[model samples]
Target: MPFINTSSPHQQNQSSVPDLMRKVLLALIPGALACLYYFGFGVLVNIVIASATALASETIMLNLRHYPVRRYLTDYSALVTAILLALALPATVPWWLTVIATSFAIVIAKQLYGGLGYNPFNPAMIGYVVALIAFPQQMTQWPVPQPGGALGLLDVLLLQLTGTLSDPAILDAVTSATPMDQIKTGIGLNRTIGEISTGALFGTVAGRGWELVNLLFLLGGLWLLWKKVINWQIPVAVLSALFFWSWMFNLYDGDLYSSPFFHLFSGGTMLCAFFIATDPVTASTTHWGRLIYGMGIGILTFIIRNWGGYPDGIAFAVILMNMAVPTIDYYTQPRVFGHQDED
Candidate 1:
């Protein structure tokens, strides 16, 4: 009998990819729950629709490509991507919109570039950008949380199945514009930051109950860091840069800018910093590279939010930096064990 060689020439490093992916899915639980709490049944419906559509599309695409659908589909990547896309979108986005975005994420952004690790851009972010561009009205509209009246899981499923959230007229009336939209409207009206904060436009820590949701995501993110599934460099650096820059700008001109808290807790900052920006494949691999990558995201995010057309820039910033990951990694490679400097 031939002897088996279990050991590598040198000790090898390995971790279960599926387990790590599962942890990431687990890490998202708090954020998802918080989103559901604040946004209501619509969020629940979005996940069901998006996940189902993503998996179904994955199976179809796998068949078309002549690949083993079970191997890739069971890896749980599609589910993770689905959850990310669903979380990023407005909870009340139509079922068809979720379907389109999820399909694009798995098909065009992921598989077309070659599956999973081969894709250059974050697949979910690609989907989100496409949806935002194609249906700005659908993506930007947000619903006010009903507090005590959130739907149970079964009810949410029914809502997704039936394509209605109770009475249609009431749904249309209550689905208000997001804080960003409100701010834009205020700016168009020549209203100052102070003027928008009063009355119905209360920040609610960036919108009613959104800050609380953000805090939960932040908490879960720290847990991920502690678990060693993610590094702190990117998230800390990104958030710090964003918060500091916003504070400085707001202090310089109170009337012109939203406050630091608003910047910290609003839009997709928490989601991007914790879940999206920390994506291992697209983000920097080296420690220094990660800092550079994250700070770049933070700066670009702030710049875009202030000067670019979109009120939230986290997704766009992430996609832009994903494009530069190779360069960032190339330049910032760590010194090897026995390498002499070019000097």
Candidate 2:
């Protein structure tokens, strides 16, 4: 008979990969619903398509790698990645593009690096960046939210499948520049922040509909924190650094810069701060390192949004910080118990 050896301090626990992923999915619901309410049914469609694609890709990759497909697939990590990528994408993105992005995320970014716990970067951000670079035209044209109504369900599905509308004229009227894009362009044209922010797209804080979406994300993030799924340091550091930098710049020249509130509630700031930057695998393991990691992302995000070519820079900033996580963790390693530092 063979004997099994067990490690010391072994104890049963309720926590698991699937359970954690499920909680994350639940946490994302409020924000997704907010998007659906403000954007349209298209958001749900993207989620469904992306989820299916991610599952299929995960299964195939597992088989090719000689891993037990069912065991790995049941964890739901790939599904969460797909959902995050879907939420990050434009509501009207074509089905093929969504498929491509989701596939790349699971196959290349996740599995190629040994999947889930081993992946050094956020897979969703990688897929998003790839899609954005490959299909700039479709990726950037986010649908404008109508005051009373958004795109019809059938119309949204049609656009996603075919990338065209039955009534071409409707496309022109329904699509408008995102608030971030408008700000960049307006500033480039030498318009003061005050003058440009007065457009219909601008709200008291951020973009008209976007601020509400961000608020829901903030609520969801709080739920994650309450559930103890994530530490508070990363989100606090990201938001604080971004707010401080934006305020400093705005104070320098009120006309040249937008307020910190606008920066907080606009684009993907809240989402990145709460969810993306807090990825355990890619983030710092030590307490102090997490704060520094988050601060780096926040400062980079601010610089890219203000000075880089892209209107939003959270994806780029997160990737850059992911590269530094190894070094950060090495230096910030927690002191071992029963050991003293040597002089």
Candidate 3:
């Protein structure tokens, strides 16, 4: 009998990279639809623009690097990055900014470090951070949520393309501070959380229209969990840590600090917990490392939201944690089975 050479861990599952990517894309649909319902057509426009830009950039980079373009394109990783970046962006952002962010995400954050699994940081987040830093005015201007979906498709296109509508009042009517920004600003002005919560933007739990969007995202996250696309450690740890910190602060002074529920359901909290922090390539591999990594993100996010310049800090927290993954994994790696330690 002849022995065959092969890789270790001969056992395999039915899931391929494309399969996993497909499931993630599927999981995002409910949240994406909710965004469209609440924020109007600009969200859809951003998705289309980002997706196109990402695909084109990926293809060009793969060709320049002499890699097999078709093989990589079929994996749908670029699409996922594109969609995530698009969703993070303000729905009212100009079309050119969307293109630039998506392109930079695919080309620089992703391919420059050697593409896909090889990249250390989350590509979507890198793009978002870059955009947020580069264009603070555009990035922070989140559209006021219109539950009736009042903004017509053409009006959104006109605004995105020209940076204005025929009537400037329309643009002014739709644009406003996000719930997170509102709370931050209100707090800065010495207004109590109670007074801020009475604003029209505040829903029963979190931001108006935003809480439901987050719930839909939570629904999608649960689906991802059920499908086993992601491990439970990171999400549970992130949410738990965030909740604990927020609860503690709120307990000390309800007038000064927002409640845990507000933090949990507001502005990318659920999305970051389930989708962003759980990026397998960037996150820690060890079981304990995952928990520690998640806790770091949660705590940092809270700190940044409260004390840092940015209203929401998920992006910064994630990137900072990504830089620590190597050290985390090394320290938290499980001991080898049956291996004895020297005294």
Local lDDT at 144 for model 1: 64
- Candidate 2, residue 242: the lDDT equals 97
Tell me the whole-model lDDT of each prediction, alpha carbons only: 0.83, 0.90, 0.91
Report model 1's TM-score to 2 decimal places. 0.90
For model 2, how does the per-residue alpha-carbon lDDT over 1-343 read when each residue is reduced to its tens digit? 8878898667775679889889888988998888888778778989999999999999999999999999999998998899999989988889999999999999999999998899999999999999988998888888785543368888898888987887878887777778999999999999999999899888888998899889999998999999888899999999999999999999999898889999999998888888888887888989999999999999999999999988899999999999999999999988899889876
Runs with alpha carbons beyond 4 Å of true place in candidate 3: 1-11
For model 2, the stretches where C-alpha displacement exceeds 4 angstroms are: 1-13, 147-149
Per-prediction CA RMSD (Å)? 3.2, 3.1, 2.1
Q: Residue 95 CA error for candidate 2 (Å)?
A: 0.9
Which should have the higher TM-score, number 1 or number 3?
Answer: 3
TM-score of each: 0.90, 0.95, 0.96
lDDT of 1 by residue, 175-207 (tens): 677776677678778899888877363656576
Ranking by TM-score: 3, 2, 1
Candidate 3's TM-score reads: 0.96
Residues 26-114 of candidate 3 have per-residue lDDT tens digits of 99999989999999889899999999999999999999999999999999999999999898999999999999899998999989999
